[model samples]
Target: MKLLKQIILLFSVGIFIWACGSSPINNKNIEKEEPVVIANDSLEYEITIIDIGFNLFLNTIAQPEGYYSQEYLETRNRIFVTNWNIRARNPSQFNDNIYENVIDYQPNIDYGYDVNYKLFNYFMFAQRKYKMTLGAGYSRRIR
Candidate 1:
């Protein structure tokens, strides 16, 4: 649990640094401060490790020396503009950016006379001003 907390903090800080690195063009003529920009998105990454215990063996009894791991990662993103602090007379003074999404995944498998199981996952997400999306899907595989 402690490790998970630290990892979450580190990931959050890294994202903050990355977001602050870029600055859009500012309107010097505006006598007041401009509003902050915000974006939106959804993301998830998880790994569930199932125990192999000492359930004997499916087909062999050489004491499984191998293992299997599975992982999943998904994300969705959208764009928006809000809190436009305007000092200039022209509405054109607004400056905004678009939103997008990126996803990643990794899985590993190891085999031996006896078998085991483990899992590994790495993923995070951040969004400020956007919408939430949920949908339904059917499961099928065609080759």
Candidate 2:
């Protein structure tokens, strides 16, 4: 009985030592795998120039009726400047392109005034949402 117990103890210790010395099969496979990295050969980065003068001209005409007010018009024409970053990835064998970028919208102005005693309230909000910026001209984009 004592001999059998000693043999069982030795077998368990051997198994523990073997397990501690050997690397796990999952870890070994992961180490052997080659990392997938895309080369920059097919990537194209471009900065687009836009003719942003149309909005300025449109500003000259946008106003409520009655007396012509420059100050009021300027306040109404609160132009919001925004930056856009676009990223696209496609393989060399693919013909289609993907589009992604940040978008901006004009700020909405809802201010009503009472002629008597100069009572007023300004409710500012966004007029539009997510205007995709395709630089230059009044060009239409289809993707």
Candidate 3:
């Protein structure tokens, strides 16, 4: 019994020592590769006026200048909000003057993804409130 206990104790100590002495798990073997950023090549804008429910009378407008800048974007957002309120109050009048009052207005600059997304959301709001069917059947392709 004495010999058996000594052997068990020795085995347990060996296991403990082995466990403690082992190398820690690490990701050193992983190769550190730099991320690749692909620049947009095409001049085509991803967000079309149609996507934002403005295809009725408005032509496809290019991204506004300084659209990437937060201040400029916020200013444009204010304009959109004001227009939205005006349109909401008088849907028929807004629709009639959309071509002359809204469509002709263009931002003289290019914008990136962020501005495009904001415009998209704003148009979506217009569609919902006005009960207009803009960009109908285009949802399936996006998915």
Candidate 4:
């Protein structure tokens, strides 16, 4: 009986050790994209986007910096921001996870070409990732 008890205890200990051991995660499949920081010291503005795959999208998918005029970017941004804010307000109606925060974008304040460009690209990236449309009149193949 004593021998049986010792064997059972040894088995339990081994099981515990195996259960507590950490399994190695496959890191190769994961692409750790860094946060995109859009800042303009002159305007005293900064926006850090930490969404995964955004950096990759901006680098590979988004158009070049000078592709879109500043006015065009601002126009699109206004429409996108308005829709985004509405969705954020009504979480029950929209996906709360996707529309997490309401963007405080002022139409009067000129956030510069850089800020507008980045923000517009972010909106584009979010639309593609979440499979949602902010506003109409934009083609699916916009890059």
Best by lDDT: 4
Q: Cα miss at 4, model 4 (Å)?
A: 50
Which residue runs of candidate 4 sit more than 4 Å off their true CA positions? Answer: 1-31
lDDT for model 4: 0.88
Give the lowest summed-lDDT range of ten residues in model 3.
29-38
Estimate the TM-score of every prediction.
0.17, 0.24, 0.26, 0.75
- What is the C-alpha RMSD, rounded to one decimal, of candidate 1? 24.3
lDDT of 3 by residue, 1-143 (tens): 99999999999999999988835443332232222221223634333232222332122342343435655454555466455555555766667433223322235435444544456444444554455533533233322
Task: Report RMSD (Å) for each prediction in the order shown.
Answer: 24.3, 22.5, 17.0, 8.3
Q: 87 in model 4: Cα distance from truth in Å?
A: 0.4
Candidate 1 lDDT, 1-143, residue by residue in tens? 99999999999999999888745443342323332212122223332212122122222432123432211112111011111112112344422221222222222322211111211110001111122111111012100
TM match of model 4 to true structure? 0.75
Better of 1 and 4 by lDDT: 4
After TM-score superposition, the amount by which residue 64's alpha carbon in candidate 2 deviates from its true location, in angstroms, is: 50
- Candidate 4 positional error at 36, Å: 0.9
Candidate 3 TM-score over all chains jointly: 0.26
Q: For each candidate in the order shown, give its overall lDDT on alpha carbons.
A: 0.25, 0.31, 0.45, 0.88
**Which residue pairs in candidate 4 collide?**
none
Q: Flag regions of model 2 displaced more than 4 Å.
A: 24-33, 39-143
